[model samples]
Target: MIEPSPVKKEPIGKLISCVYRTQLKRMSRSLGEYGIGGGGQYSFLKAILMTPGTTQDQLTVKLKFDKATTARSVKQLEAAGYIKRSADPEDRRSHRLYPTPKAVEFQPVLQALLDESNARLTRDLTPEEEDQLIVLLQKLNLED
Candidate 1:
C-alpha cells in the first residue's frame, strides 16, 4: 500500500490574514458593547487620547492610514461624541483632533477592552512565546 503525501500547512500569510480578520471581528463586537464604533475607531481613539491636539494630517501619517479613511473616522468619531475637531492654530486650513470628555472618561475602560482582546488571543501561549511572538510581529511589520 502506498502512503499519501503528508498534509501541507497553509502559508504564513494566509494564517496571519485569518487571525487578523478574526481579531477584528472580535474587537468590533467587544467595542460595540462599549457604545463605540468598531473597525477603525480603535487606532483613532488611541491616537487622539494620547495626543489631544493632533492634526488630521499628523494622524494620517502617524496611523499610516489614507486621507479618506482618516477623514471618515474623524467624522464618525466626532458624531459619536468621542472626539471633536477644531481649526489648527498654526494652520488655518488644517484641523486638530481633540478627545471629548466622554472619550476621556471611557478611556481607561477602552484600554481594558483592548487588553482583554489581546489576552484572549494569547491566552494559550506561554509568557516566553508571547514575547517572542511580539518580537516576530514587529520584525514582520518592519519588513513592510
Candidate 2:
C-alpha cells in the first residue's frame, strides 16, 4: 500500500504570525490591570520613559509605527495618566511625549513583568539557543 503524503510544513511567516498574536494576547492580559492597552503600548511607554521629551514623529520612526498608531498610543497613554504631552518648542504642530510620575513609579513593575514574559517565551530554549535565535530573527529585515 502507498504511504499517505506527509503533512505540509507551516510556513515561517505563519508561525511568526501565530506567535505574534499569542504574545499580544498575553501582554494585553498582563497589562490590563494597569489600564495599559496592549498592541505595543508597553513598548511606547518604555521608549518615552527612556527618552523623555521625544516627539511622536520620532517615536513613529524609532518604533516603526505609523503616525496614526503613535498618535493613538500617545492618546491612550495620556488618558491612562502614564504620560503627558507637551507642545514641541521648535514645532507648533508636534508634541513631545514624557512619562509621568505615575509611569516612573510603575517602571520597575513594568520591567519585571516584561522580563518574566520574555523568560517564559524562551523557557524551553537554552541560553545559547536563545542568543542564536535573536541573531537569526534580527537578520529578518521586514522594513521597506
Candidate 3:
C-alpha cells in the first residue's frame, strides 16, 4: 500500500489571506502610480459601470463590504470626479451611483492593466492549466 505524504498542509484560509494581501499590496502600488489609493474603489467603479444607478446598499452587498467602507469609497470616488451620485427618484432617501465620463474614459485603461496583470501572473501556465486552476478555485467556493 502507498503511504500518504506526511508533510503538513497549511490551512487554506491562511494561504488565501496571504495571497490576497500580497496581491493587494502590488495592486495598491500600481494604483498609487495612477494617483488612486488602495481599497475597493476600482471594483466599485467597475460595478457601477456594469449597473449604472446602483444604490450604495446594493454595492455593500455586492462587494461584501461594510456600509461605512462602501460609503467612504463612494464618497472618495465622487470627490475624485470619477463617479456621480444622485438621489433616486423612486426613493427620495436612497441615492444611486453612476460612472462619470471620466470614469468611463478610465475603464479601458483599467481593464488593460488588469489583463496585463493576469497575463504576467500566468505567463508560464498553459491555457488548460489556467482553466484548471480557476475550476479548482471555484470548487473551494462550493464548500462555503
**Best-matching candidate per TM-score:** 2
Ranking the candidates on lDDT from highest down gives 2, 1, 3
Q: Give the Å shift of residue 79 in candidate 2.
A: 0.6
Whole-model Cα lDDT of every candidate shown, in order: 0.85, 0.91, 0.82
- lDDT, candidate 1, 89-140, per-residue tens: 8889998889999999989988998899889999998898899888888788
Instruction: Give one digit per residue, the lDDT tens place, for model 3 in 1-144.
Output: 225569997888898787667666766677765655667577788899889999999999988888998999899889888889999999999999999999889889878876876787778888888897678787775321
Worst 10 residues of 2 by lDDT: 1-10
For each candidate in turn, the TM-score is 0.87, 0.90, 0.85
Per-residue lDDT of candidate 2, residues 1-144 (tens digit): 224469887888998988778887888899999999977898899999999999988999999988898889999999999999999888999888999999999999999988998899899988988998888899998887
Q: Would you give me the overall lDDT of model 1?
A: 0.85
Residue range with the least summed lDDT across 10 consecutive positions in model 3: 135-144
Better of 1 and 3 by lDDT: 1
Q: What is the C-alpha RMSD of each candidate to the true structure, in Å?
A: 4.9, 4.8, 3.4
